[model samples]
Target: ALTWWNSHVRIVGNDAADVMTWIELKKKMADTYCPRNEMKKIESEFWNLEVQEESDRVERYIGGLPDSIHGSVTASKPKTMQEATEMTTGLMDKKICTYAERQAANKRKFEDTSRNNQGQQQPPKRQDVAREYAAGSGSRPLCPKCNFNHDGPCTPRCYKCNKIGHLSHDCRSPTNANVAKNLRGNGAGQKVTCYKCGAQGHFK
Candidate 1:
């Protein structure tokens, strides 16, 4: 820059030098380094530039850039290519962070849903089943045959005859001890089996 200034700017006459300004200096430099014909040729090349090959480099990088990055950079209206690249990098980082957060949230939701389904699928306890059968009685249901809070089949005891393996209403024994005593005194052997001793002609 000093060599060009000394050779081109310093040699002007006193009257011509008086009229020279910074803008005039810049225009002279532009005219010398970038001629009108060369500028036109560069413009033409920029318009014709394509990314047909993987290793192409254009003077205007934005012209050959992919739409995804180019559109974003253009929307931000960056004044320079460096600013556009920085914006692109920041956008990608923000996108990655949001995706990671969403993935973590989805994973947590899936785990919670799985736990709920497992709890729902568990079999009910025996006492819980009995309570449900009780129909809001707030207690376990009683077995009709045994009249007790139990589940499944059972050998019932007779309330009337004081014997096991049968219900009171189905007992075949005499109704009371007095009836058996009267039958015995009259010598009437009814051939009934005793539930206690398994012997005939007696009742227990």
Candidate 2:
């Protein structure tokens, strides 16, 4: 009869229907005085299978954690799915905050270094100064005596005319001309004497 029942039983698509059919089959076998030890063995196998499946699911979830903090989470050695999930979440939050703080500090340090470099004064190069002068942006050199810009080379001033670029000895003033005329003619009509050569003809 059992063999006929097993042959007639059709495989079902619904999980609940399959389970019900299995329970019915087990009840029939029990009624036929199946050994109790065999029944216990079957129940133990089902329990072990369920436990193995749950363990695999939890391990896969743990493996999915971020690699950066994966070691830290694993080091915690969480025993359950819920513990592992909670620990990973907390560690990730802390790591993110720490990274943000480090980035902010680096930004501030860079800004300070930039500001310090800007504040430090650098001496102008001679070439750059020459370039500026050539570009007509630089000021001309001032004359120490006149306190004015001198376009040409600074030279002694003419005492008679009080003008720069010519010496007093080369001055074309009227006073020097008068002195020359007086030296050339004595008041008494005597011949002018050359002071350097002691000659009676030309004045030195």
Candidate 3:
């Protein structure tokens, strides 16, 4: 192989000397030593070669790209390997800008959500405040017998025993006549007195 290469270089002496770069040297060597059929086979393989994991060619190109810049790279429709590489190199600034813009938008959204939540935390309503104040401040005194808060006159009557102090459910006494009387407190036999005029049969 060495004898053949020397003889070939001698036959093409001036052409070999003209090889100024690595690329030119490689091209000259391939043209001289490589068979025409082998070159054609290698060219076929080079064009058809693909990444095993990635099925789509475009996806293979942009697979390593950040999501924010993927769309722009794919939209340019680069036709050659060199063109695609050039496009990616040219978009470095745009990729960074897009990523920073997305992060800024997310931060703004979080701040707005926090602001809205803070705004929604309103003061208590008038009725609720008044109810709490009345209960807490001893404005309406609690009945000592039943522990009931009352604004007017009230009797601690038990439904089960027709007596004072405990409610019907909490009455200690067994079932008796008073239990039946308490059940009939609002029955037809009882008088319906009007509080406004001290009258019966109709409400004031």
Candidate 4:
């Protein structure tokens, strides 16, 4: 699926939005940065020009607008993998600028809002934030039998009983596996003990 899609995006188009015409939208693209991830944004900061350069390089790839209707853009002379990698590093610097500008805008809104907990919340507790961005909600729920939340071992539970210890067929109760076929005549356990002579029969 992705191979087909990538082939399409790599095709160049002569449409107004494609080719070097996107240079017109450069300023807009520069301004159209995706804002900080609510959880991923860093509080303290350090400075490094090399890191900035790499960020700009990565941004070039992401900010690239197709020069053609089919969205394919290319350089006159092809580049080797090493050159492409270097270019990507420079684009990373640009990406940082884009995201930084976005974060600045967000800072103005939630600038003074106090954090709910003492420190930043962890990933499991950040589900609501994900939902706000249209990310799907988690499907986990408390186990009906053991009542364990995400803290319990991830044993497969029977959908009917909602128990995590075992599946419905292998359940110890007199149902399913035991009803028509108790081949060994043993219960759920694989081994059966003899009541007399301490000698066990394979199937009694």
TM-score to true structure, per model: 0.30, 0.42, 0.31, 0.18
Off by over 4 Å in 2: 1-54, 137-150, 154-204
**Candidate 2's residue-wise lDDT over 1-204, tens digit each?**
656455435444345445666678677667666677888998899888753565676677778887987888778877788888899889888999999999999999999999999999798998787555555632777655434455776677775556677766777765555546657665777666554344566655
Ranking by lDDT: 2, 1, 3, 4
Expressed as tens digits, the lDDT of each residue in 91-124 for candidate 3 is 8877688889999999999999999999899899
TM-score of 2: 0.42
Instruction: Report the C-alpha lDDT of model 4 over 70-166, residue by residue, as the tens digit.
Output: 1222342213434555555555567688889999988865654545443666566466654443323234555544334443565776643445677
Clashing pairs in 2: none
Q: Provide the global lDDT of candidate 3 against the true structure.
A: 0.68
Off by over 4 Å in 4: 1-78, 112-204
Residue 188, model 2, lDDT:
73
Listing every candidate in turn, what is its Cα RMSD in Å to the true structure after a full C-alpha superposition? 21.3, 22.0, 16.6, 32.2
What's the ranking of the predictions by TM-score, best on top?
2, 3, 1, 4
Q: How many residue pairs collide in each prediction?
A: 0, 0, 0, 27
